[model samples]
Each structure stands twice: as structure tokens, then as C-alpha cells.
Target: MTELMRTTSATLSRLWTGSARHLTDDELTAVATGETVAQRTLAHLDQCQRCASSLVHAADAIDLLQEEASASFDKAYTTERHQAQRRRIGRRLATLVGTESPGKVIHFPFSGRPLPQLSARSGHWIAVASAASLVIGVSAGQLLHFHAAPAKPISSDGVAVTESAQTVPLTFDMTGTVKLPLLGDGLQHPAGEWSSLTLEEFDELMGNPAFFGNDDLALTNFLMSEFGSIDALTPHVSDLPVNIQ
Candidate 1:
């Protein structure tokens, strides 16, 4: 009977020693929270200072971790979301407005109408030229009508002087008659040997030769002129038959 009682006591001690080992973190958390846990585990905590200290340490560590995470999240939110808002917005807007997509062609937004493309210096020169031309035109217009207006006759003082006229007969006298030379034949002759040649003689020299020579059109023309001159020089016979050939 004493041996059997010793065996039963040994079994009970083994069960008591193993009860704490079997307890889970949930049961320990319950104990740490001051809530009820497994009956055996609660009893072990009440007696074993080691298990109770471990449970308190786990709970405190969990609380410390939670507080640290919360603080870190708040710091990050303040820095990123509020403090950098303007800068972030500026950067985003710059990227959106200035950045071009790949393979996109740039368009000239202001090219709907043609703008005068004069350079600054060229525009200045053109303005100067226009002004100078205008001035020159105006000056020329003024100069064209610059003639002085006719002066008004001055008023004369009263005068007693009288003018008289005398009548006289006028006699006219004639000078000797002048005759002009015929056409231009009387002018200075051309250079060379034909200086004294008459009109008819000068004509024969320009004609072709006679006989085995070519027909002389110039000679025929001279002969015709000689006949005409002879006719003109002949004096017509009057009824008195004066023989004035």
C-alpha cells in the first residue's frame, strides 16, 4: 500500500510538471491580460514566478512594437504626404507638360498663320528706309511747285507828264535778190578727184563699162539726167523767133 501511494504521487508530479509546457501563447496572453486561462496553466502562473514573468515580458514587447510601428507610420505620413506635397506636385506637372512620349512628333502650336519673320535688325533697317523714302518724296513734291508767285504791281503816284506823237510817211527799200544753189549740189564736194564734176559727169563714173562689159545702168541714168537738164536750160522761142536755145 505505501508503494502504490508512492507511484500515484510520482504520476501526479509528472502531470504537474508537464502542464506549463503544454500551455500556448494564447493562454499566456489571457493570463497577461488578467483574463482566465486554462485552469492548470492559471494555477502554474499563480505559483511559478518564471512563467508569469515570461508572460508579462511577451505582452510588454508586443505593446512596445505596436507603439513603435504607429509612431513610424505617423512620421512617414507627415514627411511624405504633407511636407513634400508642393514639391511633388511641381515635379509631376513638369514631367507631364515637358516630357514627350516615345516616337511622338513635335507640333508647332503657333503656326496657324504666317507671322512676319523679319529679324530685329532687318526690321529696324526697313523702318528707316521707309521713313527716308517718305521724306524724300515729300521734299521732291514741295520742290516741284517752288516757283515764286507773280509780284503785284506797286501803286504809282500821280504824274503830270504828257506824251505826244508825230505822223510821218514810211519809205521801204529793197535789197539785191539772192538765189540759193540747187539742192545740196553746190555744197563742198566729197573727197578725191570728183570735186569739180557736174551732176551728169559724176553719174557716168558710177555706171558699168560699155561693149564686152556689163550693161551700164548708171550710164543710162546719167544720160537720162543730161537730157532732162538740157530740156530745162533751153529757152522757148517767142513769136519773134529770137533763137534763144
Candidate 2:
């Protein structure tokens, strides 16, 4: 009977030592929040001063976190803040649409008839037809205005002259394919031969009188039109600085 009593006491001592271990942080948190924890953890917290102090700290931390969360939630969901945000959005939208004032409504006159809607295929075909028509129009214009090469005239020196010294057209025609040469066939003769010519021949050699007169008139008109007068375009002696020696 004494040996059996000693064996029972040893088993009880082993169980007590195992259950007396310190509580974990999770167990302490569960206990602080009133969540169901192991009975051994509760018993340990009641006796162990260190575990009790840790549990108090954990409970205080949880309370602080809960208070902060509640304050943040209340501030975020306040009616006044939401209303102010809505007012700002409305003002921005009003400014974007050029109203510059909130609560202003714009109404358009609606026709009784529904607007015509084109299908994707129909729209594509219309675009294609427009592009084809443009291409055909341009091609036709080029073909109609196409010109053959001008016949070259042979000069007295047997050199083929491509152009004649003639008065330029009053109105420039861009549609024409032919361009008049800037230096005409008049340069075919040597410079020495010009001095030997008669006054009548020299006059003929210097192109038409209309070409020179037209150039002078064009220059004068351009200066007057651009500057309001030739005096404004060309600086006078009085307008120049007197720094020169």
C-alpha cells in the first residue's frame, strides 16, 4: 500500500511540473480578449507573476489598438467630410464644363426624330469610297494637265535653244507642267557679239520692256504693302547712327 502511494505521488508531481510551464503570447492574448484558452494556461497566469504582467501589457496594447482603429473609422466615415468631398467634386465638374457655378443645369433641345446611326461596315465603306474618290480626282487632274516636251528652237550658231526671252505671264499658273527658264536662250550668243550689235538689235536682245517694268512695279508694291511706305523699308541718312568716322 505504501509503494502504490509513492508511485501515485510521483505521477502527480510530473503532471504539475508540465502544467506549470509559462503561457505563450498567443495564449495570453486569447485570455486577455476573453477567448477560450486551455485551462492549464489560465491556471499558470493566476500563479506565475511574470505571465500575469505580460498578459496585462498585452491587454493594454489591444485596448490602445482598438481605440485608434475606432477613431480612424469614425473620422473616415464622417458625414461632413463626405459632404465636403462631394461639394469639391461638383465645383470641379462645373468648372470643367465652363459653368463656373455648382447646381446649374444645362438642357438641350431634343428633336422628335431619332438620329441616324451607321453600322461599322457602312462606315468603313463610306471611308473607302471617299479615299477612292479623292485618288481618282487627283489622278484625273494630273492626266488632264499633263504636257508634252516643248520643241527646242535652233539658234544662229546651230545650238539648240530650249527657251525664248519673253515677258513672264501676269498670273502664275501652278497647274501648268511647263516652267519658263530663268536664264533664257538669249545667252546663246557670246558677250563680244553684243557690243557689235545695232541699237535695235541690242534692244531685242534685252528681253521685252514689259518684263523689266513688271519687276520694278512688283518690288515697289511689295515694299509699300509690307512696310506702309518705301521710306520705312529703306533707312534714310538721318536715321543712321553718327558713330562712323
Misplaced by over 4 Å in model 2 are: 1-17, 79-139, 147-160, 164-245
Over 52-103, each residue of candidate 1 has an lDDT whose tens digit, in order, gives 7888798898889989999998987886577589777777777688763334
Error of 1 at 218 (Å): 90
Deviation from native of the Cα of residue 102 in model 1, angstroms: 20
Candidate 2 has an lDDT of 0.59
Best by lDDT: 2
TM-score of each: 0.25, 0.40
